[model samples]
Target: MGITKTLNDDLIANRSEVSIAEFEASRRLGAREGVGGAASWAVWGNENDDLTIFEDSAAISPRLRKDVVLIGANFGLGGDTGEFPPFKNFHARKSGGDSKLRKAITGTALEGAFLTDIVKDYPTKDAKGLPTEIKSGTLDTNRYVLSGFKTEQEALGLSRDTLYIPMGDTTRILWDLLVDRGVIPAEQRVFHRAYGNGPLFKERPVTYLRHYAGAVDMVQAVQGLLAQLNLR
Candidate 1:
């Protein structure tokens, strides 16, 4: 099928490619090699706090697909070297952050994995003043950045012809944008509504997770959703 007939113009004016290396790397990671479900799978988040979701998703299924893209919010201008989120700033205490979690997640397919951020070429900057995000046929990360869900869908090379699964609030932001454009149903836009379908997710609400083990439950939720979504 072509673009979705179910919706109108949802993409931005452009869809340019930013960092070729980053794009290729992320595409490789998002591949579903020897798998049975999606051709690829990627995850985007609000900030570093959401890495736990990625970690947990991988923990539950160690042999999980690598076609995973962790999209996080990247603020500020671009330089030659690609940019990553200032993850430390997001931590609550900042001084004595989650050490064990860091050890478990980093270099293990979770922490600091790079993808195109919503801030466009900020993740793969070579010069100072260049277009990043989305435009024409160019594509950057925009799940919640400039063009929001439209750019995100474009980055995925998808339209309403395909389906979307928003795992957490970060992705929910994009879903809400689709709703704004009359793409998604309004009822699914509930902010505080339940998210994942895992046992731990059902045991504790997303809100309650913050009060306790934090990223622990968040990881469970993403794993549940990914397991469910991959089947499609």
Candidate 2:
């Protein structure tokens, strides 16, 4: 079925996750320390480009594993053409790819999965400026961003077994960089972006999809991803 607004609404209603209001309150408190600070990153919300890292309201036992982690490239907060600009929390306005992503994960193992971006506060319309940001030293992937990512992972209680789904090539590249830097183990960079059966891809811990804003059959793509991750 094609993604619909009602699907997004129903999905939002059904999930017992942290609310935007509560998260915004947390963000406000964190912002006093600094935007994108270690504490803010650890919170289940976006620090800069309003993304939602929905944590279930019910307290999770420390021993229980969070099965999935969905990673995006960065917050695309710039551009006048944005359909749903962030309000208080970056993901407060769920339109375009945000809504598409939420809808696609419905009924799948990824439902209620923790969502975040590798690069925080680097707001652009897309990944076009990522290379520039990194090369110019304005964005520190290792010392800054990676640390925040680790903090978030630790806060979420994510383990190596957590199935990571980086949203696009940009995210995939960053994910690989993290793997190389020893932030993430090399073995965890399991599947190629194309995702096919081959000796090179005979492992687990990571899989990916096209960016939600790009041309993609969201439903079919996620269904295929579920099979790839054995979440079927």
Candidate 3:
């Protein structure tokens, strides 16, 4: 039989090994100073546009509103009639592929930081106009992931006036529980802007939450994570 990419023995053998290798290399670090800095937490997300965003009048502050509008304008925000925009940098630290492994390790560090400590959830309303806790308040950053975005830089449009949190395993667990309880359907649990490996939406939890947070932030984190892989 002719060989195909998936049918190759070497490719399959190497895939599992790569994951384990990543895990082992991460372990050698013992602990990482993840998430507190822009570089650390940024990897929790990947690129996309089409996240839910509020107009300047709806979100929190004027300065943020100004930033949002300006950023959006740069992207031709609402015009919906322009060529795709250029890649803008967030001034973050990391870049490159292998971001998944780096983000996972960084997450380990964040969980350790949050253990036994409960952070306050700033209140925000859901689509139902009912009060919803922003949740994961313990991450100590006002940022949360923005769903329904269409591009990585598009995340910036959501951040100008509202806080976003990068969703983590913890928050994802919370979302699952919400689904199980029928609080919302499993489909509602994710933002449906980009296609995953297939037609399904991919759930990437990294997000920009603080003023320093954005698409640029995620790119930086990815860079930092890839850099760490050099040790392995």
Candidate 4:
């Protein structure tokens, strides 16, 4: 139940508490809530795209209880204020990005599955800007980001059988990069072999779909994809 088990050692070592006024100041600038799931663990960012994890309370170690994982592009906004303020869980909104994602997973195997984003803290209105922002960071920092990602995955208890659902092309691209960098762990490289799962993801255990942040019928689209992969 200690943060030492859920976060990277370096992050835990650097974490601290902020004043009430400082926390409110960040929220006014559009800082939102934490990641969704049993434990409210969130990886948030700032205007600069520096990422960090925030958790309200410690839960069991490696809380990934399912074989399916939902991967997103990045946390929308909010900088690292070192404050664990309460906010809506990931994809909990009824419209726009959150609604689209919420509808897609409803009544499917993906519902309540473990969800996360590739880029942690950098917030951008359009994910298209992600590439430039990601490239803006130093090589060592980016590599550290991947190392942190690997740390989170291991902390969450993800293994080879885990099927990652990339929310869109952007997410897929980032996830692929992580894999190439060996951030996804070599043993967990099994791809979905179902016939209709598409040759695009033929080499990875990823089911592709358009980003819910756009104007797409994510529910039907994702359901169809999941059905094709025998996850319905």
> Clash number for every model?
18, 2, 26, 3
In candidate 4 the C-alpha lDDT for residue 92 amounts to: 39
Off by over 4 Å in 2: 1-56, 59-65, 78-94, 181-207, 229-232
Worst 10 residues of 1 by lDDT: 5-14
> Residue 77's C-alpha lDDT in candidate 2?
58
Please give me the total number of clashing residue pairs in predicted model 3. Answer: 26
Output the TM-score of candidate 1.
0.31
Q: Tens digit of lDDT per residue, candidate 3, span 1-232?
A: 9533211122123221112332232222212122111111112224322112111222212111111110110111112211112111111124332233234334322211111001111122121211133233332222322211211223222232221222333433443444454443444313111111211112332221111222335334432322221110
- Candidate 1 lDDT for residue 230: 15
Cα displacement (Å) at residue 186, model 1: 8.5
Q: Write the per-residue lDDT of candidate 1 for residues 1-232, one digit (tens) a residue.
A: 6533110021111222224333333333222221111122222234324544334433323322222333322322334212222222123233222332333334333333222332332333121222222223243323223443334344444344332333234434543543564544455322233333323346553321121123444444443332221111
Per-residue lDDT of 193 in model 3: 13
Q: What is the alpha-carbon lDDT of model 2 when measured against the actual structure?
A: 0.49
The whole-model lDDT of each prediction reads 0.31, 0.49, 0.22, 0.45
Error of 3 at 97 (Å): 21
Rank ordering of all candidates by TM-score, starting from the highest? 2, 4, 1, 3
Better of 1 and 4 by TM-score: 4
Instruction: Report the C-alpha lDDT of model 4 over 1-232, residue by residue, as the tens digit.
Output: 6322211122223333333333333223223222211122223223111212223223221221245556677655444423323333362323366656655565454544555566654444466666555456432324334544554444444556565566777876766655666555555532232223432333443356667777677776664555343321
TM-score of each: 0.31, 0.60, 0.21, 0.57
